[model samples]
Target: MYEMDGEEIFVIDGHVHLWDARQENIIHEGGEQFLQCFYDYHTGFTPEEEQWDIDTYRHYGADRMTEDLFGNATADMAIFQPTYLDDFYDEGFNTTEQNAELAEEYPERFVLNGSFDPRDGEEGLRYLEHLKEEYDIPGVKLYTAEWRDDSKGWRLDSDDAFEFLEKCADLGIENINAHKGPTIRPLNRDAFDVKDIDDAASSFPELNFIVNHVGLPRLDDFCWIAAQEPNVYGGLAVASAMTTNRPRKFGEIMGELLYWLGEDRVLFGSDYALWNPDWLVDQVMNAELTDEQRDEYGVELDVETMKKVMGENAAELYDIDIEAKKRQFRDDDITERFDLGTHYGGDAGAAAD
Candidate 1:
């Protein structure tokens, strides 16, 4: 939890990953290129002192990941959104099983989400069902642009993709997180298209569709679509990275989002491993819209609004009861490990409070 203006904010990092992009894991050259691209993004936006070495970044083990988040007390909880690049890597990058290794150890501190490729067809459907049965995952992260054997990518609005969405609705997995970011090498431009979300969000009103990075580089298109679709949400991952050096851009983006999607629909994402929540959370929590933006958008970036984007909105989507989780975390394994009892009102009616 973070103390800001005398209020405790229970931060839920909506996007994070635990993956292996080591040389050994690299089967195809695309894996190497992909990992390099991530490093470029890290160094491109991150502060010099806060950055990590390439070796450390490639495989920063579970121990460090746990400490980087909750140990600093910047983020109260985190959600694992897996990215499986099977075609690129020998062992898929950040699969649910890899993240579950850490999540299972600290269930109170993490929300484990699974992944599915519509290209996998029936086998994919069974795997998704297995994820829900095995882990009871509340959501699934998707990589629509992921390269398959011969295909470059698939569409979310397609009949095959709808089958998985329908299965999720049937199995009670409500959150559909799609990777809608800038175009990258090996992955085609069609992969990051935000238009497909319009149909999918409309088709599955029961499920919530979160567009990661707010479909940046296509912000206007995303905002216009989100303006019409109530179920579509924005996850601030790549967008939040701008807080370091691109405040004006951040303010403008936030302004548009608030103007279009409103406060309740935006969620925070550290895009961890790309950026650590330890420092990134502090940057994001302190984000403010300029007066011009406030006037233009006709909205306020007040504490209550930040509270929702920082944690509460994600809590609503995941059905996480904040009060109950607070009591649980007061004496949970993380608290015991970090000695953060006092933070959660320990001994002063910790549970009651």
Candidate 2:
């Protein structure tokens, strides 16, 4: 098993989603219920009521589709489980199971993340244990889009959820990636930003808490969180607005993060299904950054850092030795797949080695 060379750096996208095109069983078995509730309660939201619908995920499928979309892609993708439109089961166990199946099948390309909603008490904890024992998932993902402030009965963080996170730390699971985005409430745009995650990191210093999407609209706040909490990490996942509206500016965000936390603390992630793989790769490759900026900011800031951001940090954090996994695939043919330069820049190639 050879280490990925600096030039041949293989990327690992920390966040992506999958739905088996063949698995109609998901919707019939509680998926629809979950979606219905999500739409009714979250997306189709009014001032008094929040609205959300499964229609959000109208387009998504398994790894095969992802692979096809990322033809000759530079980075490897680590797929995570997606959430439903509604909160059918607070524990994202079923989704985790499906993700595990994909990871086990495609160990070379896909890394598994276990998702567990803290709302389900003991059942949620058991699910985390199950993921460790049965699926070998290396990380956990939580979505607080609908989290309610228990005292006021409005949506926000929950004490119960925080307690569950404390337990996750006790379980030897060091990484917890949480999603914060433009989904539900607005005023707290910066309120539940990545900085809010400092609470979890503070309570459980042993745990590595990654604030996903750089807390959506709160870039500065995300940077502050990473700056304050040693254990806290920030991510750039399908941040379409930033990447799309201002690619260079997005690189600047990365630059600031590097200034505060160094290269390794920030990670590369594509909220995949929401954003196409090719478009995201292009954004990163084209984002404005000098060699010094790249070196300082780490992955996605430049070609080399891109590789690290794609996979290395995530692999390190999750303890996934993909080099070892690649060795297991052992391709004697040494076939060169596709030249990744035309789209990515330098002539990057993948060998079946």
Candidate 3:
């Protein structure tokens, strides 16, 4: 929990992953390169002391994740977003089945979000139903660029994809978090384009479309689409990390997001394992938009807005009662057992190590 000026903030990391990227999972050289690519993003933005070695980075299991997110990072709850890179890894990377285990062990602390591949067609739709039944998932994370057999990627606007979206609507899975940001190697860059979101958002008015990373490198396009579509939301995963490395750019991005999408439609996420929530949360809590920036973007980053972005927005989306969850956190033995004192400063980075 982050407290400021006598107000306590309930934190929910809207995006997180638990994956198997170990050497054994690597199918070929591209798999190793994919790991290296992620490592580059991790090391480039991460503080020197917080950076993880390759061995630890490849497979940081559930215990470390629990410590990082809930114990040391000030998050009251986290939503697991699965990224199943079946083509790159032998056993597939971070499937819903793996994430569901964590949700099961600590039911109160986590929300399990399943995934779907539109390319799978009718069979895929059946799998989605099975996932919802087996895991009791409330939402799903869609990786439009994930490789499957001969197909390299997919789009939200595709016919089969629309069918899946319709199924989600019918099944009561309303939140659709789409990965429209950075492209892992072997996937075409166009696959990360934000254009498809426009069509999908229009087609699926009942369902919410949260574009992950806010479609970085294409923020303008995302903002344009989000501005026109009431149901389209911006997920602040990669953009939030920019607060550490590129504060000005981060301000600009936040300014634009608030200006276009408003406070209610934006959600916070650390893109965990790639980035830790401790610093991200602390940085966002402490960050302020300059007067010139406010004038330029015609937006403000006030306390209330910050409060909404950190957790309240997500709580509302997931239908989680913040006050109730806070009470549960206070009574949780696991939360009580771990010391959160180190989270005060840069020392939080060492907790992950």
Candidate with maximal lDDT = 1
lDDT tens per residue, model 1, 150-220: 77788889999999999999999999999889543534355667999999999999999999999987788
Residue pairs clashing, model 1: none
Candidate 1: Cα lDDT at 276: 93
lDDT of 3 by residue, 271-322 (tens): 9888999667888777778888989988888789988998888888889998
RMSD of 1: 1.7
lDDT of 3 at 304: 90
RMSD in Å for model 2: 7.8
User: What would the TM-scores of all predictions be?
Assistant: 0.97, 0.71, 0.93
- Between candidates 1 and 3, the one scoring higher on TM-score is 1
The Cα local distance difference test for each model comes to 0.90, 0.57, 0.84
Better-scoring candidate (TM-score), 2 or 3: 3
lDDT score of residue 1 within candidate 2:
14
Question: Which stretches in model 2 have alpha-carbon errors above 4 Å?
Answer: 1-6, 19-59, 84-94, 147-159, 185-191, 290-300, 325-353
lDDT preference between candidates 2 and 3, better one: 3
Ranking by lDDT: 1, 3, 2
lDDT, residue 335, model 3: 58
